[model samples]
Target: MGRKYLTLASALLLALCLNACGSRPGTVPPPSGGGEGEGSPLLTPASPDDCYWTAVRHESYNPSFDRTEVSTMPTEKWWADLYLNEDGTALFREVLGFGYASYLINVEWWLGADNVLRLTGEDYDGELVTMDGRMEKDRSVMLETPYGDRFYFEPAQKPDSGGALCIADLEGTWRMTGGEPGAGEKHMASLLNIERRWSDGEEGGYILRAEYYSARLLDTDTPQYETQKELLVEKREEALSDGFSGEPWSARLFSEESGAEYLAALTERNTLHLRRSDAPDGPQTVYTRSDSFLPETLTLTLADEPDDALIFYWRDPPAEVAQPLEALPMTALEKGGQNRILLVGRWYETDIQFCTGSAEQNADGTLGEWITDTVLYEGTLGIDEPQWFSLSIPEKNARLCLFMKRPWDESWFTWPITDQDPFLVSGNTFLTET
Candidate 1:
């Protein structure tokens, strides 16, 4: 009976060894060329140096409300490129397209002896996420995340010998346009000029000079150039990651006097987007390639003013008499200043009631009124007319209106008068000061 038990145990051990030697359904075996064997091509300690260019592709899946219902198609796709070196270090660059915008990520990678590739750096947002993947056959690598997502990387074509971008491309001059108030407005017109110069021996670094000018609105005269600010930016192409879709380049601009750092990205072949890196969501200024040289002198010109007819004014005194009490010029409407409205006209015999308000013209050419602080000034011509009445404007770009009461009796008549309309006039008639 003891012999029988020993034999049974030996049989069970044999069965276990056979099971371990057999391949699993979907499991990938280690490459025979790298592991210890008679004709192994790779050294005992694998080196990823020869894997020059690697392209990565990944797919992500999202489960539905009923966890069991996962769509067959992947929800999103990501692509990356990697350049590995002999020192076990690699440069990785990835492009993620989320919604309407595309974001870039650059990180450093390290390869370990056990065919383990580890990502060991953070992105621009200061978020650090590490990933581990296994290298396969010196030609490909497969990374599987804890969430079951897999990323596959294969050898890719080498980039052109000539660099994708050079400092000379950014050298010379660039013109920057587009900002808040827009062109030809009353606000100060922004004139931005950027100049780049290369150092004597360096091929990639640049000495960037930026000039900001605030000129009078729509003025060509030289006096309108009010303020000029200058900044010297140190420009270099950061090797944050391997070149994927395009070269990844960034410029770090610092003011020696202020020690403030500004971030600028080469967003396109000939375009740049710059902003304070600390304030990611803040306003970003765009600079485009320009052949024009920086102007040594700036001129100012009179900005175009809103039409005079659009300006609304109640006839002063609300009297039947036709004489001006005071001139309500457009310049009087300072950003938040107030101006009085006096009803004056020969047709003001009937009791004239006027209120100052705002309206928006629709695309169909119809006006929609947006009333704020409605104050009615009612008085009979030459009788109850107030000595003084005023209309307060909130903003320089505000559109104001003078609304008159509809004629109740047919005897009340005036030029351009209609029963259906009660509007005397409305528009952005106020002159804006720079």
Candidate 2:
């Protein structure tokens, strides 16, 4: 994420910095040279290098239950991206809050007599921001800094050229196959998803999202305490996995909200190892590739207008995520009986809730509707097994039962209705209240 750590002057900047960026202060070797920055050294890199760092707190939306999942990444609270040119001139930048505010400076850097590294940069406003630090014992981290935050460097190399793993290679959902022994019987699994996403700001690239509990949370044995991270990742070689050979296509796994860093590498073609750098042999998590989880879509398009609607069928049931979509068209209809949008999906339920009503305005300037008497109001929920259920809408039709449904999808629009929540009926008597 080009997002940085800002916090220049006021509470506004503080709020911005807190939101825009954050860091995780662990001992993962900074991505530089091939691995540790110690040799080519963050203290002095002979060649120009690139790094992306973040200090962060974030949330992911779960549309199924209309919930917001909040998380504090267990990561360094402060970090910066550094570009050290051969000429001794370097650029330093940190984003705060949401990339809305930033602290970017150009400076001349050098190592001090006591082996301390120092940097002096002048921000755009002409304020000189000075930074100094000493290499920690492992030389894998820079511990003392102006921000009291440790720093690590990352390799800016892109695998696109090295004939190594490409950006497209990482897309899909991967779940850690097993849990640490004694963890629990909950079948605990960590998830890492890489999806190619496009947006005006990011144009088109890859978005990496990961879910893992923090050390503090894990210490409490609450594997359920989840910390989800969404990071903007590109061709970065964080470090070579302990037992893996060659540079593995990797992403920086820094959890600023959780204060831990896991160096994930492709241990094998479909196998991934999320090994902690400090404890190379420590209990690590491994993942196996899987298909991206796509909820079954049920589209309801207007019989005439371009207005379209969608109702998703989550197989995992209460599937904890909601893919965003445009507002469903409730006003795309007249008082006609046959002007229905089709009701369908790789429908798990043969009797999906089908509601229809004459489009009209309410007293509150909003629109609402009642269940219609149209010959299609049968609804059903599901399990993956092929089972049958009686269809009961418009009186009861025990003969109309759901078959073992499969091949989830629909063809044409038929049932015209505005998308609404599940309706309630008393005594199986259709409500005639308008």
Q: Which candidate is the best by lDDT?
A: 1
Candidate 1 residue lDDT tens string, 304-350: 32332211233222222211211111222223334444332222234
lDDT, each prediction:
0.40, 0.37
Off by over 4 Å in 2: 1-164, 182-186, 198-223, 234-240, 245-249, 255-260, 276-279, 295-434
TM-score of 1: 0.30
Model 1 residue 56 distance off true place after TM-score fit, in angstroms: 6.2
Candidate 2 overall lDDT versus native: 0.37
Error of 1 at 11 (Å): 40
